[model samples]
Target: MKGNTLQPMTMPFRVGNVAPDPEREHAAPVRIPIGPEATLLKEPLLGRYASTRRDIDLDMDAMRAARSRGELPPFGGPWFGGMEKDVAWVNTTRVIGDASDAEELTRAEVTGRKDSVVMLDALREHSPAFKDGRLLHTSTQIGVRETRCLLGAYTLTGDDIRTQARFDDGIAVGCWPIDVRPAGDVGVHAMYVPLPYEIPYRSLLPRKTDNLLVAGRCISVDREALGSARVGATCAATGRAAGVAAALAATGGKQPRQLDAGQLRTAVRAQGGRVTPPAH
Candidate 1:
């Protein structure tokens, strides 16, 4: 996230077949009905599914974050339990939505609370990493350090990685790198950034529906770029832009991608989205 301007959207991903992201080559799987897999999911949905919604009992916090591994959804954070030096269980409810300084809180983190469960994200993106029972001084801004992506229109492979790809319908831009944590996950196999790539509008389109627009990792990018394109902040910006694009088409009586580039970008900006060229 260094050198990149941070822009995050505050919208939740719509729900449907938003399976999750990355690892290996995708054959551009089409959208299919839940087949009992999407039901009872708690992980945040993204991409095309981000454009739809489903109701569930979100009152249960742990259930709110649960997801089965049927489709291998793209999600991260410390793996819970099982080892020493594990930084997965940092407690966050203590400071969410409040303007509190993390450094100060981390400086006095209490790991001796037997009644509380906590995690220490030491890389300094979310919670400070605890070292020697002392928290490491890190950015309190809480950033997403790992990257993973869903399947997409373009097939980005390891051989084709380390370079950027320009798509016919570039809807989003990427400058972030691909980083994975705790040795292995589905998508991350490296500790560096791959060449930035453009996200295609088709990538954002759900395979079967004409009315949905996926934002975030749910949108399409190959297993490689998933790590970069699926950044939460950027995904939010993309979601905002997609929402405006959908709105303009809905209000002015048009198709999802039927608007003029300038008009669409302008509408997105007017709706509080940030876009650069081709419409700047």
Candidate 2:
């Protein structure tokens, strides 16, 4: 992370789905679960006994029509994934498309709702487990994958992860692969990391903002590097580090940028974090 080097981090838009468990008791608030049982399927209806292709196609066609009418934003092909197997957890929802407009927040909201309904319809029609399932819930809001990233003390790049870059001030670690979705005709590409890479505390310190600290996908990272660090586990780790650093800085009357890296690392480790990067 370095100073005043804010970069644009973009990713394909996606939505998620959550369905009710047929075998489980109908509780007050419907539960949506996620686990290995949730398989990410490319074609919605083409899977074995889960043929809802027609529904998916119709949804896409309708979306395209909406886009033509300026009612919906442009989006890519339909994709679906959730806990579809045995009732191990509550079903969930996931949808992805193009939603880069900052001004069109309402448009994104509409698209997410439309996408969720279409996917839910498909799940109910083809999936035996959800034939009678009800839509217990939907996301209170849409999830954005990428946005404006702070220019920090250091800007992490994809090559840093590929080479297993280490840092003396490393405060967090990320091991997820560099998974990027195709913009248009380009296919989704994922490059695995052979070893975990250290995320420097510098990456979290904004250049011009002394008291502010950034965690999660907004940390100082290039778009490619973001693919790996954007996972939940990594975000949690960064959040822990930031929280500790913020507390220490506040108590000591120091700016976040002025906190000592070693002290921060010690505090993070005491809270069950892995500060040191793994061996190459």
Candidate 3:
């Protein structure tokens, strides 16, 4: 995070509540029911699984008023509604800003909270299901999608992902596509990856920072590559590898960069991580 910074992108301030349409009577239960029916203004839902509303018209005039008053950002598409175990759920919120800076991060947090109110209001006023629904929770902080990236021993690139490159030091695997929520763009652009790719241990070793090992979305990767690696599963895998590598390094009195890649890979694989490429 110290060497260089990745370009900022839109991050959501997600909201969740007990299922507004518990019966799934109006909401489509399928993974992502796409079309004009699912959107507020009949504008095809922008992002993936954009919203849960189906065959319902929301108040467009009211949404316009909120936008004019600067209460909402350009993008406020909903994206989560389903059952989580016994509890039903709904998430309809969006707030976008460059959160790499401390001040900007704070601003995003405030704006996200405000946007949540506007989105919830829109839902309650138009959707009968949400009108009587109980509020479960809202995220306390803005989801920081990308920030400063480490310039490390190796920087993963889009080419590596496309080619399904393997590394002797591989400690984790990633399968998400290149998902980019452009600044102020309502829809996201994504490029599917052909196969799962290896994430090397070198990517976690920050240059000139022997005592530290970076992981998650902030690990060494190009902008195009970051788009793919920034998802939750990939981030979790990288974090796991970093944790294992750190423990091994500390015990051996070695810096992260100096630890043997083979030993690290073995340790990671032992933890049930996919370190080697699948057998052909």
Candidate 4:
């Protein structure tokens, strides 16, 4: 939701395991499509609209073929049937894999819109899809949730994870999973939860850089904290904080850490950001 209008691309993998939908007992295997590039994974998505067209064509081919031959929800059978445990992961993968193309169509339909590459050595990883490449639908360019921290005056550390640190410089509040999209477009790193949290100004700081502030997945956080702050709602708040801090620093000729704490808190409060009262 970074408001990126990145175009979608569909590049299918070499192998596929269609979960035979018992209902469609007359159809053949449905080939699942590949995912888009993370670099290109932006909102207001543009460019790769053709990928959706190709996918629909292929999926139609698959559905027709499956129906002509007879297939059903899962075309494979027993294995896919008992895969309920992995449902969450599979469903999430569909974001960049299957539904992304479909979702892009919504851009043309509702907002209206547009599309991944396949992978080679996935089974080696401890991914849930590891059963001899049985149920996994990994991609070519692994999903990358974020990049550089943008470098700020203070860098957030791992310990700040669940402790719920506060700052007069704090500018946003967010709570989500430590969701890390994988390197190849399919696999991702995520932790389940943590308390509702506020992104510290430190998270905006790069190791040794200054001025620029970073928010979203690029924030400094622990493996767990990253998961918690990765959600869109959370990132948005973090972004809002960065924007305010940057503006203040640029206009006042003050560093982020040097800004008047009282003034910073007042500004953030004005924006509906929730902060804890000072601890005497």
Highest lDDT: give the candidate number.
3
Error of 1 at 234 (Å): 1.5
Q: How does candidate 4 score on lDDT?
A: 0.42
Q: Sort the candidates on TM-score, descending order.
A: 3, 2, 4, 1
The lDDT of each candidate is 0.39, 0.59, 0.65, 0.42
Q: lDDT tens digits, residues 21-45, model 3?
A: 3453544554533331212212332
Worst 10 residues of 3 by lDDT: 34-43
Candidate 1 residue lDDT tens string, 1-280: 1212211111111112212222312233334233321132123422222211121111222322332432222233322211122222222212211113355334323221211222221212222222223332323333332233334444444333354545445555554555323322221122344434455555665555566666776565554455456567768767876777788779988867565666765666566554542321
RMSD of 4: 15.4
- TM-score for candidate 4, residues paired by index: 0.44
Per-residue accuracy of model 4 over 1-280 as CA lDDT, tens digit each: 1212221222222223322223432223432232321122222232122121111111223332443553321111001222232221221222222223544433322211111111212221223233333434433333334333344455554345455666656666654434433323221223333344456666675656566667786677654455456567777877777788888998999877666766766777898876452232
TM-score of 1: 0.42
Structural similarity to truth (TM-score) of each candidate: 0.42, 0.64, 0.74, 0.44
**lDDT winner, 1 or 4:** 4
Q: How many angstroms is residue 220 displaced in model 3 relative to the true structure, after the best TM-score fit?
A: 0.2
Q: Once superposed on the true structure, which residue ranges of model 2 sit more than 4 Å away at CA?
A: 1-102, 122-134, 185-194, 278-280
Better of 1 and 3 by lDDT: 3
**Clash totals for all candidate models:** 24, 27, 2, 53
| Model 3, residue pairs in steric clash | 19-88, 50-78
- Give per-residue CA lDDT, model 2, range 16-94, as digits (tens): 3433344543233332232223222233222221221212222334444644765433343333333343221221222
